[model samples]
Target: MRKPQQTPAQATTPYIDALLGYRTRGMVAFHTPGHKLGKGAPPIMREVFGAALLAVDVAMAGGVEDTRESTGLVRRAEDLAAAAWGGERCFFLVNGSTSGIHSLLLGLAGPGDGVILPRNAHKSVQAALIFSGAVPHYVEPTIDPLWGIPLNVPAERVAAAVAAHPESKAVFVVSPSSNGVCAALDAIAGVAHQGGLPLVVDQAWGPHLRFCSRLPLDAMSAGADAMVTSVHKLISGLTQSSAIVARGERLGLQRLESVVKMTQSTSPQALIYASIDAARAQMATQGEQLWSRAVDNAEWLRARLAPLEGVRVLSDEVLGQDGVADLDRTRVTVSAAGLGVTGYELETALRDDYGIAVEAADPLNVLLNVTYGDSHDDVALFAAAMTDLAARRRGARPLHGAALPANWPRFTRQVMTPRDAFFARSEAVPVEHTAGRVSAEMVAPYPPGIPIVAPGEEISDEIAAYLSEAAARAMHVHGPEDLTLKTLRVVS
Candidate 1:
């Protein structure tokens, strides 16, 4: 039987309504005491203004919500989120994906337990290891030399890991990576679940996936046990606003919420929650429409840019290679190899001249994110600007920078659990001398936001060389200090 067309409100999730209610009720809050919703926020802003929205900064009001114990508004919001995302339970994360990952690692898995993780994850994953005290098994990703960016880890690698380490309690992987490269989640999840482990997807870049099937499949639907998303990344939410979707009977909502409460802020931003609700409402009503528009806009943009000289545009072909299942087309990652400039040079010119900033600037490629709000005109303008750039360059282009190091490094074995290495007495060493020693920090190039080296992994000379090249390009790589990577901190 054909299903009835859903009304916007019917599509409106319950979490969306709760968010509306918070805004609708503007009554002065004196109950939580600290918030002073009508009064100034404490210490940080010794404000005396009653009208300041900053004062809306509130505490866990007894009657409204209790994020720590999560029995009030938080409970309802999470319930609705689960229904919206088709997960068994959903947890709100005011602290962002970092906290969600930390909580999942510490709560779902145990000390001495092993967790397999993608080498391309963020620093927060390293933080999770420190807190969880779990041993980590590393999985390397395929680097596309043409793009100079790391792709998602293959399913075969994951399956092999699961087979090798049956004791692994969980696996961490990301889809719709910052550059928009995606992986075969269903296949990875199949491996984890078959081995009696939970698969955790750091789907921070993929919040809009489920809203439109044309984009990519949502992590939950792909059988991941838990998926973390940052609403601020793709939607109109305040920073640090995030959510964790958990499916399957294997996970415990009570335990997960406890971990969140343990790590998250006590005085949660009602603003963050409201923003999440607002995004949810927008998605509920115009999900298919909004995402549909975004996808169409991206398609139009890529097609227009494809013919431009000196511009090599990357697409599903770059992503759909051996290990991946699907590609996210929203990210237009263009390499100026054919042109006479590095991505950095083009990015600087674009900002200075056109006043249009790309998503991220790197040595090789600059990513431009296309959303539902963009129009064909914007795409045409971008293409024209590139054409002008190519014409100016003529036949001249910057010499290709040092070729990326041929061989990358890998960790030998688990010398110590992350929690142990993090806390164990340690000392500083030069980057070159640090090889074979456990790493104390996450060092990675920016733009793509993928860490080439993370905490607890054995440091290597090759890794050091790759990082040095990135720094030479003035790339924003987040990690320990460069050169010697000196003053290294270890378990003390």
Candidate 2:
């Protein structure tokens, strides 16, 4: 006798299916959205996004089902994502990776807890430090002398930090720096695991790494305890779409979910959730072909740019050095400083003259992100413009890479916890006189966006001077309320 056919639920896109079902129901509307779908929506919004998009905009409750606990569409979507990413569990984040970082830090570390992390962390990690009340044992990253960009900290450094601070609650590391430099994460993960600690890798720039073998190792396969990634950064997802995946019971899944719930919104955007689900499916199904083309374009650009006079394109040779175990070839970082121009200057000229918009830039290098959407024509135009600019070298001024002066303050004494300093009474004072005083805010140079001085850190004269000079040079200084850098926010 023939066996009965078993019904298998579609695994590719459960959230999207639920959303479509909710949208097609012709039920009378009485929901939180006063817009009542596109009927009550404004003309401009409807015309721009269209009625179809607006119609699917819904609340977590009621429309999908009468109660908060419905068909478990969101949970099923998360399961699909976990399966795709090779995580034991996964949680969808609508507020971006910032919230995921904050949630993980809060879940794993608490007051008086020490966490081993590199100092070149994103501003969000600093904020996580403040939010979680975790004390950080800072490790400096290896600097690339050519571009002056901070790469990953050596695994030995992480091991030393873990060994020195046995009381440390967790270890956090950022691989694949914004400039595409990847750290020795497998070794780092081993060190953390040997110490019986969880490794949290901020993989905001590596969502596509798993989809493409040509890319560097992803955090999940590297044995990270918890990994937070921004799907919108390198994958096909809307802005603010992110996900957190957990592999081990070290950071309890229940605890992570609780913290995530606290950090996320009750009225989360349905469209964002659907987009994440869809993006995951697309990557699982079609990412190999898409990223192969992207890598080809990046390789072509690298070859074309390397032969140009005074242009140094970053290559695989940087691997095998301390803190540099691998590289993401899709990111094209060209050193324009040697061409008698600042990365900022080259960026402006490219945009204004050739209509080519690059990604982040500093004094030394310009970063170009090659995505699957880019066409061959786009690459040709960029190459032609770069070659023309190289031929017309302005002057032979020796390149002064954007390395901070020896006196520049890279580290300041931490007198108080970030949480205390953030909540303490504070007053504004002259930036010059802020030396020896405790800071009440974060001050960072923009392009790289690493905080030079965060709350609870003492403000040194060297740091104040460096920041003041950076402002004068027109490098965008972010995080501080006083953009002019003439005043400093300090603990009263």
Best-performing candidate as measured by TM-score: 2
User: What are the per-residue Cα lDDT tens digits for candidate 1 across 1-492?
Assistant: 111122344344444445445546865665664555545455455544334454445555542445435556666666656666668787777888878888888887777888888877777777787777777787878777677777788999999888998888888898877888888998898888888888889998887777775777778878888899988888766899998888756677778878878988777777677677667666656777787888888888788778777788788686467566777788788877677667787788888888788888777678888877678788778887887777788787544654333234454455667677666677766554555667666665555555666666665667655655545544565666543344344323
TM-score of 1: 0.87
In model 2, what are the clashing residue pairs, if there are any?
none
Residue 2 alpha-carbon offset, candidate 2, angstroms: 39
Q: Poorest 10 consecutive residues of model 1 by lDDT?
A: 1-10
Off by over 4 Å in 2: 1-11, 66-68, 394-398, 401-409
Estimate the overall C-alpha local distance difference test score of candidate 2.
Answer: 0.82
Task: List model 2 lDDT by residue over 346-450, tens digit each.
Answer: 889899989999988777778988988898888889899999888788565646644333122568788888888888999988777788899988887776678
> What's model 1's overall lDDT?
0.72
The candidate that achieves the highest lDDT relative to the unseen native structure: 2
Backbone clashes for every candidate come to: 6, 0
- What value does the lDDT take at residue 296 in candidate 2? 95
